[model samples]
Target: MSFLTFGVGPSKLSAETAQDLRNAADLQIAEISHRSQAFAEISRRALGGLRTFLRIPDSYHILYTSSASEAMELTIQSTVELASFHFAQGKWSQYFADIAKHFRRRVLIDTVEWGQKNDFRNTFVPTEADLITICHSETSTGVACDLADIRAVRHRFPSTFLAVDGTSIMGAVAVDIALADIWLFSVQKCFGLPAGLGVMIVHERVFERAADLIARGVHNPGVFNLPAMFTMVQKDCNTVATPNVLGIYLLAQQMERWNAQCTMESRERETREKAELLGRAIEKSSSFRFLVRAPEDRSPTVCCVRSDPQTITSLHALCRAQGIELGKGYGKLKEETVRIANFPAITCGDIQRLLQVLEHVRSRTPAA
Candidate 1:
C-alpha cells in the first residue's frame, strides 16, 4: 500500500521522478565519470533548467554541495572574517548561528519566541559583522520571513553579505532571488526528490569578499570553498569532488516538469490556497491550531499545528495506522505540535484525505 507522509523530508517522490531514477540506473548515469561529456551535458541542462524555472539572474553563480548544512558551513567559512549577525526564529536559523560560532567567529543573534516571527525592523547588526544570515523559511517552526524584510535588510546594510536558507520553500514559493547575496536550498524538501544535493545561488559580491579575505590572509580558501567551487563550475560544470549525478539528473527532470506544467507564479498561488484550506480546517477543529499566529508569516510549504501532548501523539498514531504519516514537531515543540508538509508533490486530494482523517479523529476526542 502507498503512504503519504507530511514530513519536511525526504518527501514523497512523484511517479515520474521515480521512473526517471530507474531510467538513470538502466543507463548507468551514476557510474559515468564526472569529467565525461555526458555528465557535462547533464550539468549544463540542470543549471539551465534551474535558471529558467527560478528566474535566476545572469549575475548570480550557481554551485552544488552535499546539503544545505554544508552550504551554511561553506558560506560562513569563506565570507565571514570577524563576525556575523543572525535574525533567528527557529532551530535551523539558530543552528546557522551556532555554525558561525563554531568557526570561532563572534556571533550576535537576535532571537524571537519559538512560534513567533523575527522582527527585523527593530533589530540592528553590528558594524563589525561582515555577514548577515536569515532563514527565509524556518522549517522547524513553519514561519517564512517575507522577501521584503530581506530587501529591507539589504538596503540598511549595503556592504554586508546576506545569506538566506531557503531550505523548505525554495521551489514551491516565489522568492525574490536578487534580494540576497546568497540563497541556498536542498532538493529534498520542496523539489520532492531524494536528499543529498544542495543548490546555492551566489552573487558576485560573495566571490569578491572571498577573494578579499584570501588576499588579506584572514581566511584560507579551503579545497571545497566557494571560490574553488566557482572555479570548478566554470571549468566543467562539476564540483571539487565527485558529485551526486543521479540527484542532479532527477532535479533537472523535475524542474523541466514544473516549468512545463505550472509556472512558479501559478504554483505559488495554488500553494497558498492549499495552505489556507488546511489552516482553516485546523482552526475549526478543537484539537489543533496553527503554531504561527499571523497568517502572513506562516509558511506556504510547511504547515505546523499546536495541540496538547497526548492529542498530538494520538493524532500521529491514528494517521499512521490509516497508512498516512504526519510529521512530528521539531525542537522544543516536539511534543506540543504536529508538522505537515504542503510541498508541490502533495496534491490537493492528498490534503483532503488528510483532513478527512483529522475530522474523524477529532469527532471522537474530547475538546482540549
Candidate 2:
C-alpha cells in the first residue's frame, strides 16, 4: 500500500519534482561535465531561483555543500580563527557546536533545556569568539528561536559573525536572510527534495573573514572550504567540486513551482495553520501534548508531541499499519515523544487524515 510518512526527511516530493527528475534523466543532466556550459546554465538557474525564493541580499554569495552538517563544518573552519560561541538548545545545535570543537576551536556553548526558548537577548557572547551560531529551528524538540531574539543578539555583538542553521524551516516558513551573516539549509527538509544537497548563503563580511584568515596563513581544514567554494561560485555558479547535479535541477524546478503557484507568504500561512491544527489536537488529547509548551516558541514546520513511551510506539505502529508514518522522537526524548512534519509538501487533507488516525489510536489504547 502507498504510505504518507511525516518523518522529517526525505519528505514527499511534488508531482512536478518527480517529473523534473525524469526529464533531467531523459536529457542526461547527470552525465554532463560539471564545467560544461549546460551544467553551468543549470547551476546559474538554480542559484537564481534560490536567491529569488529566499530574498537573499546582493551582498551575500550563495554556495552549495553536500549537507547542512557540511555547511556547519565549512562555516566553523573558514570563519572561526580561535573560538566560537553557539546557542545550543537541542541536539542539532549541540551537534554544530561539537563540529567546531572537533576542529580544535575553543567553543563556548550557552545551552538551554530542551523544549525551551533561548533568551539570547540577555546572554552575553564572549568577545574572544569571532563567530556565533544559532539554529533557527531545532528539529529534535520542535523549538524555534525567535527572529527578534536573533536580531537582538546581532545588535549586542555587532562585530561577531552570526550563522543560522535554517534546516527545518527554510522553505516552509518566512525567514529574514539578513538576520544572520551566514544562513544554511538542506533541501531534504522544507524543500521536499531528495537528500544530499545543502545551500549556504554567505554575507560579504563572511567572505572578508575568510580572506583575512587565508592571508594570515590560517588555512581552512576541509577539502570544500568556503574560500575555494566562493571562488567557484563567483566563476560560474558551480561548486568547488562535482555536485549533485540532479539535486540542483530538482531544487530549481521546485523553487520555480513554489514561486508560480504558492508564494512563500501563502506557504508560511498554511504552515502556521497546519501547525496550530496539530497542536490543538495534541493538546486536547489525553495521550499527547506539545513537547514545547510555549505556543509562540513552537516550530511551525516540525510539531513534536509528548506522550508515554508505549503510546508513542503504539501510535507509530498504528499509523504505519494505516500507511501513515510519523517521526519518532529524537535524542533524549526518543522514548516518549512523536514528531510530525508540518512541511509545505504535507497538504491540509494529509494532516486531517493524520489527526483522524491519531484520534482513533488514542481512543483504542489507554494512556500509559
Candidate 3:
C-alpha cells in the first residue's frame, strides 16, 4: 500500500516522528551544497547518530549508496572472488545471491520455505565460500534468522565473511551489529523515511577482502568500490556519488529524536507489545489467520495474515477506500495474504482502526 511507502507521514512507529519536514524547511537542508561545510556537518551528525542508535563498533565503517541493492552489488562484486553462499530465507535474501550470480561468482544457496528459518548448520556452508549472506528480517515471509544461529555460523566458519540484510527491521529492532562483517539496509521500512538512501555498515575485514580481490587482478570495483567509498566516507562523512542529502538530514533528525526519547530496548518492548496485540487480533479473527503460524517465526515489524483470495481482495479495497493502507503479500502469497507493517510510524490508534475495519469486513464475509 502507498502508506507503507511514506503514505503515513510523522506518526511512524520507529525512529520517525512529526514536524520532520518543517524542521528541514527551517534549516533549509535542501539548499546546501553537497561538498559545502554545512552538508559535511549534517553528514557527521547523521553518521554519529547512526553509531549511537545502532551501536556500531569501532571495527566497522559505514558507506552510503543509491539503494540497498546497490550495496549488495558493490559487496558482491568487490569481495566475492570464488563463490558466495546464501541462506535464502525469502525473496530478498535470494536477491542477494542473484546479485552475486550476476557478477559471475559461483553462488550456492540453502533455500528455505516461507515462514521457516534457514539452516545455519555447517553442512550447508561451503569452505571455499568467500561470503555468507542472510536476511535478519525477511520482510516477505515475516520470518527472522536468529542472531544466535548467525553467530554459530560465524564460529564454525571463522574465515568466511558474513553479510546480513536489515532492510525491513533496522530502525525498529536491536541488532548485534557485530554479528556480521557487512550489514546493509534501506531507509524506507524501519527507519520510517522516504526511500533512495542505502546504508552499508562494513567490517574492516570486508575492506581487506576487497583489497585482496583487487591485488589478485580479478576484482570488479564497480563505480563505487569499497576502498573508494571508504575514502569519501573519511572525507568528513561524505559519500562517493552526489549523495541523498535530504534523506541523510531527515535520518539524522529522526535518529536524534529516537535517541532522546526512546532507548532501543524500549523501542523493542513497544514492538513486542504491538506484535502481541496484533497476534491476538489475528488469532481472534475468523476471516484472517496468520500466514506464519509459529510465534517465533513472526517478524517483530512485518505481520502477514492469510485469508481467502476474495476476502483479501475485499479487505484491500475496504482499507483503501477509508484512507487506511496495509502492505501486500509478495511472491506466491500475494493474493491470499495481506501484510500489516508493524512499523512505529503506524500508531496503536492506527492499528485499532485497521483491526476495526478488518473485523467489520469479516463479520459480513464467510471464511473459506
Q: Which prediction has the highest lDDT against the true structure?
A: 1
In model 1, state the lDDT of residue 13.
Answer: 84
Alpha-carbon deviation at 334 in model 1, angstroms: 1.0
| lDDT sort, best first | 1, 2, 3
Which model is ahead, 1 or 3, in terms of lDDT? 1
Alpha-carbon local distance difference test for all models: 0.88, 0.86, 0.81
* Tens-digit per-residue lDDT, 1-368, candidate 1: 98888889888788899899999999898898999998988898888888888899999999999999999998898789889999999999998999999889999999999878888766878999988998988999999888888888989998888999999999998888888899999999989999999999999888878888888987766688888889999987888999999999888888888888987799899988888889889889987888998888998888999887888888888899889898889979999888899998888888998998888655335655
Model 3 Cα lDDT, one tens digit per residue, 1-368: 33422131122434234467667888888989999999998898888889998999999998888788998997787778889999987788899999998888899989878877777865567788988888888888888766687788888888888888888877777888888899998887778877788899999888877878887887856558898888899988997778989889988887888889887788888888887888898888888877777788788888888888888899888888877767778889999887788876766767777877777666345653
Candidate No. with top TM-score: 1
* Worst 10-residue lDDT window, candidate 1: 359-368
RMSD of each: 1.5, 1.6, 2.6
Please estimate how well model 3 matches the true structure, expressed as its whole-model Cα lDDT.
0.81
TM-score of each: 0.97, 0.96, 0.93
| Displacement of the residue 321 alpha carbon in candidate 1, Å | 1.2
